[model samples]
Each structure stands twice: as C-alpha cells, then as structure tokens.
Target: MRVYVAKSGDSLLKISETHKIDLNKLLIVNPHISSPMMNITGSKVYFPSSPISDTLQTPISECPLPSPSDLLSSWIPLTSLEQMADTDYDVLIVGSGAGGGSVLRRLAEQWLNSGKKVGMIEAGSLLLPTHVRNIPTVNDTRFSQYFHTVSKWTGKYLPDFPGARQLFALGGRTLFWGMSAPRMDDSEFFDWPMPLKEMKYYYNIAEKIMRVSTAYMEGSSIQEILLKRLHENGFPEARDVPTPADLEVTKYGQIHSDVFWSSISALAYALNRMPFDLAVNARAVEVIVEQNEVVGIRVMSPNKRAYVLKAKTIVLSGSTFETPRLLLHSGIKGRAIGHYLTNHSLLLATAKVSRQQFPEVLGTLSIFIPQTKKHLYQIQMGGPGGEDQWYLWYSQYEEKALLDELLIGISAFGKVESRFENYITLDPNKQDKYGVPKINVNFSYSKQDTEIIHQMAAALNQVSSAMQAPLIVPNNRQAICLMPPGGDYHEVGTCRMGDDPHTSVTNRYGQVHGVAGLYVADNSVFPSMGAANPTLTTVALSIRTADYIVNQLK
Candidate 1:
C-alpha cells in the first residue's frame, strides 16, 4: 500500500479502512506519527500491504510513546491541508465523550509518547468556550439552552426540557452532567464479561484523571433526623453518599472540578500540547466496512458536505442510544444493538416544613438502601417542603417558616431486566433535516420499579419524621416530574459486551468480534445496568479500551 497524507478533517481509521489494510500494518510502515496533540493535516505516512490483524493479535508487553523527533516531523500547520497522501497511524479514536475522552488522555500520555501517530476524531461543535465556570451561574442559558440542543445530530427533537438536551456538543454529555461520581461495587464490575480486578484499577485511574470528588457539605436537620430514624427503623447503615465534588472537599480537603465540557479540557489537564484534528460541527453518517471489518466512516459537516475517512482501527464512543443506532445503520445487526436499556428513575415526594428547618441542606446528598438482591432504593436530598413543587410537587403547609422555603428532590434507581419492549428504532416515517432517521425510544417501567420507589418514599418519610420533615407521597401521576422512564438521564446497555459473539456485539476487550480493529467503549457496551451512575464505569471501560489498543499497537 502507498503512503497517504491526511488532509483537512481526515482520520486515520477512515483511510486504512478504505484500502482494506490492517491498522497496525499501516502504522508500522510509518512509525513516526503525531499524536492527537497535533493537527498534522499535511503530514506524510506510509501504508503497508500486510494486515495488522495478524501481527496485533499477540499482545505487546508495553505501550510506547512517540519520540520528540517524530512529533516534530509530524507537525503540520493547523491551517495546512494535503488530503490525498497516504499515511498510517497506530490507532484512530472517534467521539470525544466519556469513553473517547478518557482513552485519548491515556493514549496521548503513553502510546503517543512512543512517537506513534494517533488520530482522534470528534463530530460535534465545541459548545463550551474557554473559561466557562468564571461566567456566573451554572444554569446560564449558554449551557442550558444552546449547548444542550446544538450538539445533537440526530436531526430529531424530543420533549423539550429533559429529552431534547442530550446533544452532541464538544464535551459530549459531560458538560451538563450532575458530576455524580460514584464507584461501581465489586459485584457490579465482576458481573461484567471482562475480569473485575483490572476494571477496578482502571476505574480508579479514570476517576483521578476526571478529578472526581466525593460529596460534602452540611446535612440538613431533616437528613440527620431521617438517618437516625432509619437506624431506629432497622436500617442504620443507610446514609447519604456525597458527590465527587462534595467528596473532594470532605474527604481529601480538595476542591477539584471536572474537565468534561470540552475536548480541550480532556487533553489540557493531562498537560498535553499536541496538535490534534478535532473537527466540530461534523456528524458521522455511516460506518464503512469491507470484508466484514470496519475501515472508516462517512461524515457530513455542518455545511452538508460529505467526506469519507479511512482508518485502521475505529472506536465508537457514542453514548448508549446513538452507538446502537450507528451500528444498525452500518448493518451490523446484532440482537443486542438496542436491547437491555436502563436509566435511573427519580421519584419526587412533597411535604411542608418550617423555614427554620431549611438552613442546613446544601448540596445533593443521598441515602442508599439495597433492598433484596435485585431491588434497591435511594432517598435523595432536599429542603423544607413545598420547594418540591417547582420541581416535584406543590405544598400547602401552614407555618410561615415552613411553607416559604420548603424544597426537596430525591431519586431512586431500580435495576430492570432487559426487555424486548424497551427498545430503540428509527422512526421510518420521520427524518431529521440531515435525513437521518428520527430515533424513537420506546421505554416504560415495570411494576417492580414502581414498588421500589414507593417503598423508598415510605422509608424516607419515616426518616423525615424524626427531623420534623413530613412528606406526602403523591399518586404516581402527580409525581411525573420526579420519576420518569429517563428521569435521571443515566441510559445504558444498548450494545453490550460479552464473551458470546453470537449474543454480543463487542467482546470482553471491547473489540467487535467480526470486525477487526473496530471497538466500542461507552455505555453502549454495558451488559447489565448496575444501580449507580454510569459515567464512572464508562470512563473505566474507555481506559481499558485505551490499554487494549496500546497493547495491540505494540
């Protein structure tokens, strides 16, 4: 194969795939390649005839980084373009969400240090501007209105507030995440297809990189009383768990923040300064495959211009919902593509409390209850009483102090079995402006879900009574704002990873069974949705993918 040079918006995975060449072989021919740190649009690279699949099957002992000379040689003017040259890179990463973001951070530090050209591709606009937190309220319209909806390339609309917000902006969904960074229990990780030990280590590494912190802040009187009551009610260990941000201050005395709103944050925090080709406003249209192996992808820019990219290896970091949609569009029909979908439900209960009782509650705190083996419950943090009305349900408590400052919010996540009824399909009759099918998500809760939430609420009320914060559990219909199928926005398990190729889309190592050099490292690979936030786990799996890619490259 001839050497190829990447031009404007070119990706390595798209190129090698175009010629049916192995990604490792292509990189072998051109050993000195730039990392995502550089945007080497005019850099030259070699293409080899042998398939990387054969050579890369054997695991390498260590991951190597590119040399300084290689980095210099691969440096192309950020503005330069030379599209038609043949060059090979060790790996190519797609998407810049939790999965892609974590891998790129690791790869840039390790493999890229060995002087290997690594190409990272992103197909959404950079919604976040530099120096975001300094801009006042976190609820600023820039983040709430524009950044939220603009990232979506689905070309279809969902319910306004919560649904339409899952856009494809620069940091992906990380920008608006509640920053809840809970660790997955051993049972959660052990149940996965891959070994649990390595996964736990990876989770730790990812948490460090993301600067995840634990929850902190003074607990409200209600929280204190509730815990005491739970103890009295035979559940003493159940208490509120802090968020990553809260924990940083509480546990480590650190006030670290997150780096998810921008791709730049992911690279910059790692202290990396390489030029990488990060194309914004570009949407991946299809996955191009030949001989049953993924080669590259077709992308459409905001201008409606279509471009084809070839790469030796392709990793899909799109979220759970979109990942399956992409695979199905590319014709990789697996039963697991859009099955076993799970998202935590938030059930809001209202009550009236005295204003004097509202002084203590600070941040989002939660009390977890592991009910039975499969069923679990959580009573989230809140204030006074009627405050739940704007968010959950209205209140009519009489006391002046009680009725005025009453606000509460709580959510419970119940693990549900994968059912055929809960699925995703392209609305054949509808299409976005870009002509992609409008995604129609059909999701509802089982009776078990309802039972758990009601039970959780009863427990919460008992606890609140100890603190003088009584709650009125409304009918399910009235609590619509708090508990919905996709309330917490934690969606997972669309394209699961497993040992059985016949039943799974990706293997334990995240590699697509039939497709060489193609892997998915996102919530899409989750087989069973554990009763916790999915971001940290997604980060861990992505890091694992990075390690796997590094091994194969070596």
Candidate 2:
C-alpha cells in the first residue's frame, strides 16, 4: 500500500481513478473515508498495490457497479431536454421560488424513501453565485442589472412610479431579499381559509428550516440603546426584528451578523439526500386540462420547442404576476384570476444620530414598531440595505460626513386594501419572447391607502423626535418621500384563497377551485397584504399545502 496526500478539490472518485485502483478496492483500503465523492483535501488516502489498467481491463460482468443515476444522487441533477422528454412525474411543481421551493422540500422529505418522483421546473436559469454576489447599486442607470421594467406599463402610471421588479432565477427574489422573516398578525388572516391555530404549526416549522431568530444583533450596543429608548417611550411593539441571521461577536467586540437568505435553490440543495429532479429554463405556456382536471403542462424550452410533461399533480408557485399570466394563458377563467392585486405602500425617511448621544453605538440595528390598528402600518427602524455596503450605495454623497454617526433609515409600510379595480389583464397586442401575452397591471392607490401613508409618516416623525434624531434629507426634501408602487416588491392577492370558488382562485389548502390536482402556493394566494413581509407566510402556507397534498395522495 502507498500513502497519498489528497490535494485541494480531490475527491475519492478522482483519487481512485488517478491511482488506477478499483473503487471497491480503494474503499476497502481507506475504511476511514466517509464518502467517495467528498472532497478530501489535505487528507491522507491509501492506495492499493494494483496496476492502473487492471481494474479498467476487468470484465464488466464480473465487476458489479452502481448505475450512473445512483452515483449522481448526491446533488439535485439539473434535467436536460433529452432526460425530461418522455418522462412522467408524481408531482410537478412549477416555479422554483420561495413557495415552490418550500413545498418541494416538504414533499421531498415526506416521500424521499417512498420512491415518489417530485419534479420542479423553473422558468429561469439556475441561480449562480455570481448573479447575487455582485448586486448593483440602487442608482437609476444600474437598476436594470437586477430588475426589468414592464414595457407595457411604462407610460400608463405616473412618471415617479417605479415599475415592478422580478428576478428570473432558481431562487427567484429570495436570492436578493432583505431576509426579514416577520410573521403576520392573527387579524391579518381574518379572511384566510385556514384558521390561525393551523398556520402557527407550519410557521414554527418554517422558522426552524429558515433559522429565524429574534435575537439577531442582540448584543450590539446600538441595539441595546435603541431598544431601551423605544421601550421607555411607550412603544412596546418596538422589538428586535426577526431575521434569518446568526450573530457572532468577536473577542474584540466587532459584531458580524451573517444573514440566512433561504431560497428555493437552498431547499433543493438540502434535498440532495433525497431522490428528485429539477428542470431549469423550462417555461410553462399552458396547462393541459381534461374534464376540469390537470393531466399535463405544455412547456416551452429556450429554443422555442414545446413539449408536454405528464404529471399526477400540478402546482403553480410562480409569483403574483407570472402565476396569473400562466393561469390566464391556460384558459383558467375566473373573476379573481388576476384581480384584487395588492402591495405595501412604502415611505422612505432617514435620521442622523449624533455621536454625542450614544458614543458606544456600533454597527446596524433593526427594530419594528407595530401600530395599534390591526393590518395598518409598521414602522421599521433600519434601512433596506442591511449592511454597510448598502448604506454607502443608497446614501447621498452629501451625507458622507454622517456615515460615521448616522442611524440613516426609517421606512413605513402600510397595508393596501384589496380592491377589484387593482387588477391584471393579458395585453391584446404585446407578447414576450415565448409568444405569450404580456401582463397589464391596472392598479392605483385607494383613498384609504393615502390616509394610511400620511398617518404612518406622522408616526415615523414622532419616533424621530423621541429619539432626538434629525432627518437626513437627500435632494433637500422637507418631508418623507413615498416610493413608487411595487417598490417594496411585496405584491400579493392576485389569486386569493377563500372558501367560495366564485370569489377566489384557490381554496384554504391552496388547491385551485374546481380544478383537481392543480394548486397555487405563492403570494398570489394571499387574501390581503399584511404589514409584515410575505415571504415567511408564503413558505408556511406552502408547507401546509404540501401536507394536504400528501394526505390526498395517500
């Protein structure tokens, strides 16, 4: 036997191939090795005394081997066109975003050992590390790097209105989300089909999977001072913002909080131990329904070739916009197919905290102040850009002086009442690259929405005064600035969930009304937009839906 020191990126398979030994012999000699595919960098590997060609020259009948599919099960294999063709799946999940990803995870966990084929098809490409690593600045010119403007709605709304932004990747928007994991208030679910008690169980499961913690940035001096001030000033709702971040303090007291940005890709990656397939860059053009039951989906590939994927179950977890467009294209007629659209009204403000007030302040701190009225508005005490990098990106050049001693942000997010007028419809003339009709959003703020914004702004000002911080105005603005509609990117309520089939698109369990085996699990199923971020709720509800589907399959 010869000793071999594995170099970086050296796997057992590579080592065995390089050493010209049979994989079984290599494993027999290296009993301490845990996995054959694991990168055993800097580890010692033993080589058997066998000629390199001996194993290669062996008869295939004598040398039993695992199949190629068995060897590739360590990772979720990205399916190619040839592999996806002429195949059937037990469950076909469309849109590998947050909701879709969560449902896939739950289903994969439940049916991992059951040999059930759960296939996930995404309209976008695989989310690469490079795509999210180099996030563009919030400047107007560079904004298109991460966001695309809806061409049809460009000239319809006000000039100041910022159009909706959608990310076309395996993880979808979760790749670039702010990682806020706040839960909805019970009152927010008053119109939901499921009760609050059932949702709480799923919320607990999601919180664990996402690693959500309210103690994020707990030991920071700035957080301590801010929490004390808020509590003393009678703002009980001003507590630590729940986030999927792990806080680590160095011996030198330097704070480093690592955010846990859970995406669909992460969920798929975690299911490596399970058996599943994920097909990327496959956009669903239509659902093949027979006798009001979905049997297959007509998908178009990047090269414009269309094919049918047969499945026992179908789920549409596409975002609020794309899901509706897919349903309309599939001839799923309903009054609420693309209506009752709602998103949060965002108001951005900034404040400067003098160094003299609290000298021990360091790093960023976030706190949420909930309003007394249910489903009204919540005042967030941190900037959208969580870290110092984002702080420098959005802050004005003139405010550079206050960078060392600035609190820098206040945002008021008010719930928009769901109205029938705020709806989406397929455009008659416009079509995207896939020859599908483009979506037309006919939405405007209601009178109650305007009043809520004014109230939220005043409340933010009150907090600024109590904290003894002054406004940091950019462009010499004297008051709070309202960001254009869809700025928050928390759009929901397009395919709302309710008990009535005529009024809503999906039922309590996310099953499409009158369409067996067709489900909707994304934010499009929201009945109303709660003040909290919708990602957590979307995930929790998806978990619930997955359980329902599993029970039905049984």
Candidate 3:
C-alpha cells in the first residue's frame, strides 16, 4: 500500500483523479471517508497495491460505511484523569459549552499545526446518542437527566423566580438550547466594554463557523403577516430570525424549509477529529494559584480520585453560577465576581393563527421586534403549543378540527438591569457530593423590568388584535403570562468586563483583572444582558478572547 498525505483542500474525488483509481475503490479502502467532498487535510490516505479495472463494480450490499458514532469514536480518545495529570498543557479550558467550545476550536486549530497541546475538562459525562438524537420537551424526564446534580437554587432572596438549570454534559446547555442566534442591536451594546465594530467582526466569524442562516422569513406565512403589521406600524427593524441552520433549497432556487440548528455538540464532534485532548466526568474543584498567577487546576474524577493538571493558561467557561462558585472557592475575591447577576424577564403570549388564511405555514418562524423606547422582544409563529394530539383531546377539541388552528406565540425578553442585590454567593456551610461549595443565588426583577413586561404585553395584545386572532388563555389571565426570572436561561453579568479592575473581574479581552494566565469566556463575563439571547454574543466574545490568547502566546 502507498501512503498519500492529504493537503489543504484535498478531496477524495481529486485524489482519485490524481491517482487514477476509481472513486468506489477509494471509498472502499478508506472506510473512514464518509463523503467524497469531505476535507481530509493533515491526514494520511492509503492506496491499493495495484490499480483495479476502471470498470470494476462493487456490490452495494458488500460496501459498508462507518456510522456517525463509529466516526466520532475514532476521532479522539478520551483522556483518563491520570493521563491528563501526567502531561502539562499549553492551554486548558474548563467547560465545553458554546463559549468554551468555540475558544477550544479556535485555539486548537491554530495550535494543532504547531504541536501545542490543548486540553478541555468537562464536569459532566459524555453526551450519549440518545441525548443528541431526541427532542424532548422541557418538562420531560429526559431533560432533567442531562443536567448537573446541583441544578437548583437555595437562598433567602429566592422569590417565585425560576430555578437555575445547569447542564454539565460535553456541550453544556447548548445541547438543548433553543438555537436562537440573533445579533445584538447597536442600542443593546451601549453598556458593552468594547466597541461595536470590534464585536461585529467577531460576530461574523462566529456566525460563519456556526452556519447561521441568513434566509429567515422566506416561506412562512405567519412571518409575512407579522412583517406587514410591523411595517404598517412603522417598525421596520422587525426582520427575519437569524438561526444557525441551513435552509433547504429547491430546484427553482427558492429556499423555504428549515433545517436543524447548529449546536456545540456538533462543533465538539468536529474538534475531536483534530489533535486535542478532552477529559469528561472530571469536575474542576479549584484553581492552583501561586504568586497571584494561575498555574494549574485541581480536578476530581468520577470515582472520587483527585488529580492536579498543570497548564500555562486557564480559562473558566463554566456557566454564570458555576464560574463564580469556582472563583470564590479558589479564594479569588472581587466585589463584581458574583454581583450584577441578571437574566431577561420572559413574557409569553399565544394566539391561534388562522390556518385557513395561510394553510402553507406549518412550522415556526421567529421575528425580532426592537422597541425604540422600550425593551426588545421576539415573536414566534406556529410554536409547539397547538401541535400535540393529546393536548387537543384534553382541551375538548378534536385534532382534526384544530388542523386550521396553529398556535403563534410571542416572547418578550425584558432587559433586566443588573443590580448588586441580584448575586450568587458560595454557601459557607454546604457542599456538593464532589466536595465543591454549593451556590446560593439571589436574583429578582426591578421596577423597570416590570414596566418593560407591561409594555411588551400591550404590544402583543395589539399584534393579536391586528391579526384578528383570539388569545389562548390557559390560566385565565387577562394579559400575557410573565415567567419568573432566569426563565429564559440567559443569565449573565456576573463577572463583568470593564476598564476598571476594582469594579469588574475581567478586562475587555476577558482576562482576569488581577490574576495573570486566568481568563473567563462564558456568559459570566458579560457586562450587560441585552434583550437578545446570550449564546451568539457569548460565542463571538469567546472567539475574540481566543484570538487574543493566541497572539499573547505567540
């Protein structure tokens, strides 16, 4: 067998044409080659000893291709706690959510060619196929099974507020995110530490990598009606939703269908194909700091074994709650470490869409409604409210009769002003099973938040009236239903970024204010939580931070 090193832009077709071997033969020999157009750069390809007949025919039943699991299993081997502790790494990332996953991919791609080692520690176990393949509802038991054990809040300030849901799997909460990736408007970035231009550049990079689709409201009839209504009301900023999915294109060049949105699990699977190390079920206990600098991290394995892994740089991408808990447990002190905790106030209002008027609109379509003088909100048409047959039966309506009654829901995410009172602190007397400090969360909405919710309710009522669709009132509410704080799961502003070290925990580049070689790349570092969802912005910020770290290392 002859070995051929695949270069950049090398494809199986090109290799077959160059070597004068049949495509089927090439695929048969290299079972790992899933697709002909797949880029196998920096890898070795094996050729047969002699070229077979040009007309060689292989039986379809005889040829077996590798499954996604097979391919993923062969990508990278999971490192054991002992193995990880034995070697020092150039960069160590904690958490594998969108922020940490993006940073790891960016840095690993740049450092892979240089032979620099990059390590990632995930507190949760590896995500199983059952977790990724199923789309369970929020109330489903499977949903709870994927989260961390300590996913609830305990504190005096806990109001009727919704409890925090923490997912500690390979991709964190991103494995079950709504996949709404909207760019923050200019007004929303007023409180951001960096300039909008710099942030926009990183947003472009993140959108490109995540495959955020641009064709938003092309085929949805509900979106068309909403756009017309917004235009008639002089709100032109209400545009099609930007999601991380590829739209299905037709033969006539019209894009109409919606695909599954991108997730961090897919990104992690791709990154695992590269040269990197990932340790799962390894909970980070503390940062091994020496002389005011981070040198390593202490982690406990699943079997109660502890290990200390050395690294030149440590990045904390744990969620807002866990990140602050880790820092506080490590004896890192800052007034802003766990202060300014904020999440958007979620208000959901639903109305039945006239299916007779638009029978073609079947799936959901998201639209952003930016308020010039108030909080920005999002409107989604054809949600999951009126889809289930069991729900129709329980509501005393036949499923066949409700075929023309699609549910259109609007979500208004009010901008909750970050306050010092809404914060998370480590419980002095409590500890989790892993011997880590338990977190006590204290968060509540302000008066302004209430005002924004009222405004959003009023706007939703106007839209429902304009559409001539009656509101779906389940709880006998006069207006919209206001969900508790943290309902959106868009918590941020804990470890805020600012120019002043005393007021913020991290700088503009996400590096720690007083601690060297320590950085934060998750929503915990957000200075402000705009009405927009935090996933896209968190990813963009993480990419920028990764670029900065690469430059600093160089």
Candidate 4:
C-alpha cells in the first residue's frame, strides 16, 4: 500500500479524490480515521498501492498521467487564449455578469450533450467565487473596504457622471448589488421592441432561478409596523422588496451556501449541466466582421499577446460602458452604438425613528415603493441601524448600549429619459495597457428630468413625514442629497434595442443591427429601464437572446 502523508486542510474525501481511490476502500485500509469527511492533517493515510478500475481485472497504465483536476481552477475548467484560438466555438459570450451568465446557463441547460462548443472570456480575473454576501468572514464594513480595493472608480474621470465605478470580475457588479430584484413597470416596457407577454414569461423563469423572495421581512416587526404605516398613509403600494436571496434550508447533500444569488451562481449551474471553456484576463480587443457578417474576435492575453478566436456567434455583455466602447472601437457601423445613455437619478437621506415606535422585538425594515403612472420614481427604505442593518454579508447580533433611535436609510430612483445627448464615446486620447480606448461620458439632466428629481425629493419628504420620521441632514450634508448621475450603477441604453437600425444598436432579439451573428445582451440593450433595477430585465433579455442563438444554430 502507498503511504501518503496529509498536509494542512486535507480531508479524507479530498485525499481519496486526489489519489483516485474510493472512500470505502480508503476507510477499509485505515481504520484509525473516524469518518470519511474528517480532516486528517499532518497524519499518514494508507492508500491503495495499485490503481483499480471497474473492469474485471486490475487496471494498469503504461504511461504516467498527472492529476485530473485543473491546475488553474479545481471547481471549473479554465483554458488559455492560445488553446482557445485552435478550436472554433459555437457560441462565445463576453463578460460574466447577470446577462452573460444567464445566457450561458440557459444555453448549457438547453444544449446539454448536444456537442456544441460554448466558451466565455472575461477581461478581469476571478475576484470571488460567489456573491460577497455569501462569504462568512465579510461583514458590512469589511465588504465595503474590500469592494473599494477591487473596484475601479471610473467616475473620477467622467466629470458629468462622477459617481460611476467599474467592477471587472467574474460575477460583475452583482457581487455587491443591493439584491432588490424588481421588474420594470408594465408601462415602462412599452417603448421596448420586444413583446410584453414574452417578457413576462421569461421574467417568471428568471425569478425562479434567482430565488426572488419576500421572505426576508417575514417575521420582522419593524417592517410590519412601517409597512402598515406607509400603506395607511399616502403610499398604499409599499411592500416588501423582492430580493434574489436563497433562504431555503440545506438538506441532504445539497448545501445552500449561496444565500445571495449572483452571476457566479449562474456560472455554477452552467458548469454542472455542460462543460465550457473559460478564460479570465482575456480582453476582446476587436470583433472581427467581414462584409457586415460576424466572423470571430481578436482577444488579447494579459501578456500583450493576441489570439484570434473563431466563433460564429458572439454576444457582447461587457456592460453599458464597455459594450459600446467595443462596438465603436471595432468600427461596427451603427448610428446609436453609443447614444441614448440613461440611468436612475438617485437621492439619499436618513432619519432616526424613536425605538418606542415598534414593539420590544424590533427587527430590520426593508420595503420598496414601486413606480406608478403618477410617480416616475421608486423608493427603497431599509434598516434599523447604520452598521447593523439587514442584508449585510454576515449579520451580527450583540449586546450594546441601549438607544432610543432607529436609523433608517431612505433612497429614491427617478427615471432618467433616454436621450441622444447623454452618450458614451471612445476616448482615443486615453488608452489602457491593452491599447483599448477609454470611455468618455457625456450626460446631463433635461428640464423633464429635473422636474422628476424634484418630484422624487418631494416624495421622500412626504414619505418620511408620513412615517413620523423626519429627514435628518448629517453634518456637511444637505437635507436631501441628490446622488451623482452614475452613482446608482444602473446606466443603460447606450446600445439600446429598437426596430430602426439608425436609432438603435441591437434589434429586438439582442442581435447587433445589420451585423449577422453579433449580439449585445447586457443593461446596454434596455430602451428604457424606468425606475426598476436593471438586473432582472437584463437577465430575462439575455435568456431570450440565448434562445434566439440556439434556434438560429438549428
């Protein structure tokens, strides 16, 4: 028998997997180990001396082979750009955010064992395997610090949109999103090229996979009282926010470690159904087009080497900023490639409610006021404290000094009209290390938009007054602060969808206008996202686009 010494963090199951031996066989050989799942660190474990297989006779090999696990990543397979250039892919998705992830997941489910080659390339490296909230060690404060370290404050360069920040990672911005998954108002979708009925069908599927739930405020007394107060007051439509959070209990072998769903969740689902090649730090410099037909992509490695990846179908999900930059930089012809930029105009305020307002059992308050025909903005109210608020990475409960105040964060998002003046253009003067042109944002509010912002601010005042929680202005802050244009991180419509090629970048199916086999499936495709958060709609449209690509392949 082979005597193998265990190192730190080595478990019996991991050892059995590393040595290609069954758990029972390892247990039989060494009775000292209590369980197969127990960690055996700095200890000797007897392994099966000879290799065995399911065949009648003992399995023998003439040539020695390395471990089956991927050296770069054990959870999912990773291939280099050099290797990817050798094979043609049926579908190659750019970006790994909500849109790109949903597309990959749906395609993997629909094309399982179909012998189709699907690949994905991300310009950023693997930042986190799951949503930051799923990590146990990351509390709200820690998360804030870590996020600042990993994300790029791109807004610093855009004078008009100073609040914009970019996160280039596997899961994208969903890693730190508020998780409030609200669909756009039915009227808001009126201008979109896609049908409303079809949108509803896909929305249902997206909700199921993302685990949208109102169970968060189930037993919270604070929410109960606050909700009742808002309903009785002018705002009767106030209710618990639908968050894409998996709160189900883990049973059997299924571990529900993913409390908050993100694009990494989608990636995991896709990998389970089918195998796909993934390459991080691989940037798509240009989309190769020939006579108005898509051919492949010119991708660059981190080391400045370029590789030509042949893919008949390419979906650009690099987001509102990056997608349009790629299209314009690649010289793809389209009038609306980088126009009609839109985002929710946000306002922030906080208030302190008396602790005597609710019962002794005080829980967090999280509610949303949806957009209505009369009101063009939506409101999100949450929290019982500044640091000890709900929906953090990992909540903590501890005894502290008694207080008579309840801290609540109030925010409103007003619908910004999609306009040609508000656009993103390639800044040829500035370039990254890869020679990719940086983006220059040109944005401002119109008279109508300013009116809406004023309305939103008034609504906040009214809501706060109605709740008996007067809005409080902190030191060096105004009574109601209007967040910067890009602060909401909801930018969209740069490459909007429409029937007219002269006015839009992608068509109804997310395919790039006048370019065969090229598609755009991120927030950039939204004609008008309204006051709703763009995550859910982005995913739904992506799923539809993936289906379109699948049907086209057949």
TM-score of each predicted structure versus truth:
0.71, 0.79, 0.78, 0.87
The regions of model 4 sitting more than 4 angstroms off are 1-75, 387-393, 396-402
Give lDDT tens digits, candidate 3, residues 1-554. Answer: 77889989898988998878778878877888899888899778877655453336534466788887555553346777788899888889999887888888788666666878778999986664222323423232334354434343332234534545666777777766766788776786777788989999999988887778746446666667757776676566677667776545565875433243434544554465456778989999998889988899999988888999999999999988888889999998787889889888888877776667655534345776654544455444334245442121112122333465667667777777878888988877889888887877777678887787777788778767765666887557744787767667888988988888777899999998888899999998888776787898999999899999999889
- Give a tens-digit lDDT track for model 2, residues 186-240: 7877777777898899999988877789775666666668778777775767887
Roughly what TM-score does model 3 have, to 2 decimal places?
Answer: 0.78
Most accurate candidate by TM-score: 4
Winning candidate number (lDDT): 4
**How close to the true structure is residue 207 of candidate 1, measured as C-alpha lDDT?**
68
lDDT of each: 0.61, 0.76, 0.74, 0.88
Model 1 misplacement above 4 A: 1-87, 130-134, 139-165, 218-234, 240-242, 246-264, 270-275, 350-374, 382-406, 472-482
Q: Please, what are the lDDT tens digits per residue for candidate 1 over residues 1-554?
A: 56677777655565666667666665666667644234557778676644555566677787788877455322122211124113354566668777887777777777544766556556665555432432334323344454444545332344321342365655677666655566655666566787777877887787677655433324445556556666786666565653443123224664334322333456554435444455555677688889987777776767677766667778888787778877877787677677666666566655445556434442223454443344464444433234222321111231223245455544555555555566787778876556677677777778876676666656665655644555554554453244445656677877778888766778898988788888898887887765667787888888888888888877
Worst 10 residues of 1 by lDDT: 73-82
Candidate 4 C-alpha lDDT tens digits along 1-554: 67889989888899988877788778877899988888889999987554432332456779967775624454557888988999899999999999999999999989999999999999998888898878867766678889889999999999989999889988899888888999999998788887899999999999998999898778899898888889889889999999888887889889998889899999999999998999999999999999888989999988899999999899999989999999998999898989999999999988778988788887667899999999999999987775353331244453333457877889999998899899989887999998999999999999989999999999999999878888887767997999988999999999899999989988899999889999998999998878988899899999999999999999
